[model samples]
Target: MLNTQWRVLFVFIVLLIASALIANHLTGRVFNYHDPIGSVRAIYEDIKTKIEMAEESELTAIKTIAAPSLSAKTAMQKHLPQADTTRCVDVSLGKVKYKRNGNIYTWTDSNGVPHFSDEKPDFEAATLDTDFVEPLDYFELTLHAANLPPSFTEELRIKLNTVFKVYGQIIGVDALKKVRLNLTVFATRRSYEQAIKLRGADPTNTDGMYFHSTNSALINYRNEQSAMRTAVHEAVHAVNKAILGSTPRWLNEGLAEYFEYTKNSMQLVSVEPHPGWVNNKRVAQSVFTINWLIGLDDTWQTGDDTKLYASSWAAIYFMMDSNKGKQFLKSIMLAEQKSPCSKLTAAELKNMLYQHFPQLDKDYRQWLKTPFRKQSF
Candidate 1:
């Protein structure tokens, strides 16, 4: 009915109109185009849900990480006993709490002595004793002397204090003053055994022990002499821990063995020489040499604990007897203390001996063959 060009234009317009109608229909059906605002609201709701889920997941992760430390603190709190403020001598029963009473207060004097007061003392250097003992300059002595006589307990306390003072001198006054010791003496063997059981240690194996976790030492007092010697032996380990942080296994046991035979008198306290009764017999039978001692491993596990102890003690004794060795030992101790993470390696010990005492190897061999002699501290 029209010209060719006009007819083609009309057909094209009709096709475009039909395509638009189809597109609108498809969009409305598939995309909910009629409720455009609702579609946007659905999308926002999905995003909100995902964000909330992510936050919840993050919160769960945080809780998982924090749970163990919280449980550990709670467990420690449960295991340790509460503090008692009524007594003059406070025992370490868990964390030391310095709660003030009505007007009667407890405090430590400048000399690190604990005292009670109705009014605040005139001393400017007074600190709360119970809290300060474990945390500061003074060592804490918790004596459970329920079965022993009161006089004996009092005397024992004095002797132990003297031991601490002697240890301070050996390590250096300033070094020892930085840390505190926690010593627990069980009055009877029964109580000591009970404590060993509670602590998950073998009573048969351990007569005295130093617990690193709690920074405490435990001893069974059989009599005056035995208790004192044992305390000194354990205290050496404690001193090492406080100052050097880590000591070689041989040196640690060796020092303990060497120091165990201390002679305590009214005038002085000294580390006496070994009588050779405990370890000398074993040491005498074994092939003893400087290189052998240095290279010796499988120390305690090889069922040669007695020999190991003797060898260690003998080595320490030889070194300690010499003035040069004393200075060398002091230098190493100071170095180790300054760097807490450092350990006493075998190489370092050998190198030090070589530097300080070049003929140490020869001297040590000669000393090993000699009989044990009593030397004054």
Candidate 2:
């Protein structure tokens, strides 16, 4: 194809120069004609030489443009964040059930196969330095408990980090990674309540609470399953504040409720129909209009906790169920802090919401009226 182009270009150049040469020859002959064949032959040789050189130059230019630079591609790839599979924590060895200091013991069997155990051998054994999982630069969790099983505590920690990963995938790891999340787990309800009280939070009817001032999560271990859910829920809030600075009440609560139940995976792994606030029938009768939910700043005194939570959960469920919905949600998430700890005004956030989902009020209400279980998306 390139050769064809070059040949056609050469032919066009030859035709153009031939026309010019004919005109020049006529003018020269009118003035003084002598050795016209020699003059024409000399002109033809010069044009041919120049055209050949021009064609080579043109081919060089085309080749330069056609070739891709492997060095440039490698440089671009260096700027992109590489995925670390080791960073995905479904379980944490950091929460050691039994103390073995910091190292894990390993040995080889008679068949020259590797064997692993917590026990140290008398001879022919090597110790593998398996350190506890280090915390991210901006995130840390401390389990302040003396009675809870270390195994269960590790499981809870895994679930919480999974929440971080889930939102990290959504909001971006760069943002979530810089999030300063401090989570503390209390062994008993009495101690948990005391801790929240000391933080000046009224722990009247809550299993867990996320204090935005300190960017920390405080949890009460009432039961294994419930406490795990609460920890996951609060972890989402910590992540939210770290990434977005502050989110609307509906968004904050909806995300919390979403991750609270969805376990061990980035998405709804089971998609199971559970009797959570998201599946609550009260969402259908919620007082929150789409506009109201978007405009709400900090006034959470809605009188009915169930309906409020259910409404928020429903709105988030509807937003996450479609590609457009997820896009809309992502738009709001990108509203990061402008000043130090500053937030976007209600008007700004409202504009973003409408811009992304114009008929959000009507569309949200319509979505809530759909069949219930599929909200798991």
User: Residue 335 lDDT in model 2?
Assistant: 60
lDDT of 2 at 302: 26
Q: Which residue pairs of candidate 2 clash? A: none
lDDT of 2: 0.59
Q: Name the best candidate (by TM-score).
A: 2
Clashing residue pairs, backbone N/CA/C < 3 A, model 1: none
Query: Which sections of candidate 2 miss by over 4 Å?
Result: 1-139, 178-180, 265-274, 278-287, 337-340, 374-377
lDDT of 2 by residue, 1-377 (tens): 99999999898667656645663754332211355445556566666777799998898778657855433312211110011223212221121122335567898788999888768777767888885443333346665555567886677666666565555445554444444445677787799889878966667666777765555677777667766677667777766655565556677777777666664455444222224542354343445776676666454542245555666777676766777777777667776533314456778777877887888777877867767654332
Provide the overall lDDT of each model, using Cα atoms, as 2-decimal numbers.
0.57, 0.59
State, as a TM-score between 0 and 1, how close model 2 is to the true structure. Answer: 0.56
